[model samples]
Target: MSQSTAKAAAADASASAALRARSEVARLISYIVIGSGAAFLSLRASTLPTSRWEPLGAGSFPELVFGVLAVLCLTAAVRAVIDIRKAGGANRLGTSFAKWLVARRYSFALFGLLVVYLALLPLGGFSLTTFVFLLIAQLMIAGISKKTLIQSLIAAMIFSVGLNMLFAEVFNVFLPRGVLFAG
Candidate 1:
């Protein structure tokens, strides 16, 4: 092969290896996080109160589910660790993590929006809070333009107000009313 072609091929291989290493590291992180959460829940579930009358206690189901989840997470974490070690032990973890943050910037923004939406739900009211959040999130993702703005507003109104009305009137399930709208 030509020298230039051979160098290009080597570069491609290096890039592929780096991508693989990053993926394994990300998997390891996810497994660790999920495992910790599962373990905590399992422990909490164990201390829950049981029922006297019924054969199965209130905590029985939760305990079983969380225990199983914890075990599965542990198993997955071990496998991820093995993969990471084989891929050279996450030496580039910081680099991969920084790249991940940049790549998923929009996802982080959406999560932030969700947190705000939930926090303001009680105070602002469900419909209003949801409507504003939806409109903003949609516009943030889809970008602002004349057509998109109108469409997103329509969509936000329909989903926010329609769901509230449907749940309250049709399903006879009332959502939490905002303190502002309580009176």
Candidate 2:
């Protein structure tokens, strides 16, 4: 094989090893939870009132969406299970998990930031939350420097506040308002 191809093959082989069992297990668990949640939502959506003029109920779209989501999640769980099996078992899970975390420290940090940003959105409003998230995420990616910080701030403000205004004025779609900010 060519040099790059051989390197890729080696990487793939390493990726397919038992080191990934922990991540696969995590994926499996998340898929199961998401699938169950979607199934529950679908069940709830089925009870929405139907109008006589329309063939479908008001909840029909939601039901279809949630049902599809549940099915997809289940499929993903199956794939995760297959991956877990291929990666061996729980024997090396503990040892390999630390290695995986160390190797993906930056990814995990960004993921954690995303989760926090999402969780805080309702409380902070779309404008403030989006701006903060954009600034921090950009800084994390670009590294901290005075020029980059200012640039990130400006970009974040433009996108966040500008988008909020565009949606409110042009599109007539009002974003979620935070309790902290009284419009």
Question: For each candidate, what is the lDDT?
Answer: 0.87, 0.87
lDDT of 1 by residue, 71-156 (tens): 88889878877887786846778888787678899999999999999999999898999999999999999999999999999999
In order, how many clashes per candidate?
Answer: 0, 0
Can you tell me which runs of candidate 2 are displaced by over 4 Å?
A: 1-90
Estimate the Cα RMSD of every predicted model relative to the unseen true structure. Answer: 4.1, 6.4
> In angstroms, how far off is 37's CA in candidate 2?
10
Stretches of candidate 1 above 4 Å error?
1-13, 34-82
Candidate 2 lDDT over 118-177, as tens digits, reads 898889999999999999999999999999999999999999999999999999999987
Query: Residue 22 error for model 1, in Å?
Result: 0.8
Scored by TM-score, the top model is 1
